[model samples]
Target: VRLSVPTGFGHMVMSGWLIEFKRQYPDIALDLLFDNRVDDLLRDEVDVAVRVMSEPPQQMVATELAQVRYVTCASESYSREHPM
Candidate 1:
């Protein structure tokens, strides 16, 4: 199977998953493409792609795997001064 994943996520998360998957399914061949550029799914450049976006393309089938949450924090001095 050919998989296209972003650089950071592919390196930190998918690499480990791929290792375990390879261990379990030794017969299946896996090709990984780690790139920041957006790939053309309709053109069949990749069988599957891991993308981070607010919305998926209307023409393609998509599944929501996970959601990213962001946290904002301020230092004590800044918090005291800005009183939010």
Candidate 2:
């Protein structure tokens, strides 16, 4: 099965998990396509797309695989420089 994922997420927290997935599902071929923009599923370019935001098309099916908590942070130098 083909899988399309954002380059950002794959490189961050997701890459390690995907490596485990690859080891488990060695029999199945996984095509990892990374892009910044959302892909058109109808075009058959991507069978599945994983993104941080929920943007599934109306005609397509989407399942909430996981929920992520958000955090807002800034560096000490940046904070001192900005002085907010």
Candidate 3:
């Protein structure tokens, strides 16, 4: 399988999964690519891409593997200056 993943979460999150997947599917070959930039799915650069986004692109089919929640934080001074 050709897999494209982002740099930030690639090694941190997907490494474990890739290990297990390889163990289970030892016969299948994998090509892994890491980049922060969004790849063109229509061009078939990668068969699958692991991305963190509010929504996936319109052109491709997606399956939600997990949901990520982001917390916004700031210093006391910055928070005080920009009050919600």
Candidate 4:
């Protein structure tokens, strides 16, 4: 499978899912690509992708893997100086 994932993808999948996947399907070859941009399906650049998009693209079929949350953090001094 040609898997296209984000450049900064979490290690959770790599550490577990991918390990098990390879173990279960040792014969199936895998091409792992890391990039932020999504490739066109017509081009056949990748068969599967994992992206952290705010909204799904109109042209592609997407499934909700998980809901993402945002957090802001600052140093103690900086936070005190710049109160929200």
Best by TM-score: 4
Model 4 misplaced regions, further than 4 Å:
10-15, 39-41
Provide the TM-score for each candidate, comma-separated.
0.73, 0.75, 0.75, 0.80
- What are the candidates' C-alpha RMSDs? 3.0, 2.1, 2.7, 2.1
Ranking by lDDT: 3, 1, 4, 2
After superposing candidate 1 on the true structure, give the runs of residues whose Cα lies further than 4 Å from its correct spot. 71-84
Clashes of each: 0, 0, 0, 0
Residue-level lDDT tens digits of model 2 in 1-84 = 788777877788679888899899899888888875664665757877787775666766778777768877899999999886
Please provide, for model 4 over 1-84, each residue's C-alpha lDDT reduced to its tens digit, 9 standing for 90 to 100: 898777765354444677788999999998887767875755857888888998878998899777777789899999899996
Instruction: Tell me the deviation in Å of residue 32 in model 2.
Output: 0.7
Error of 1 at 22 (Å): 0.6
Error of 1 at 69 (Å): 2.4
- Score candidate 4 by lDDT: 0.77
Q: Give the clashing pairs for model 2.
A: none
Task: Please give the lDDT score at residue 11 for candidate 1.
Answer: 90
How many clashing residue pairs are found in candidate 4?
Answer: 0
Q: Residue 17 in model 3: shift from native, Å?
A: 0.5
- Encode model 1's per-residue lDDT on 1-84: one tens digit a residue: 988888887897778888999999999998888876665764756888887777777877889877767678999999999997
Candidate 1 vs candidate 2, TM-score winner: 2
What are the Cα lDDT values of the candidates?
Answer: 0.82, 0.77, 0.84, 0.77
Worst 10 residues of 4 by lDDT: 7-16
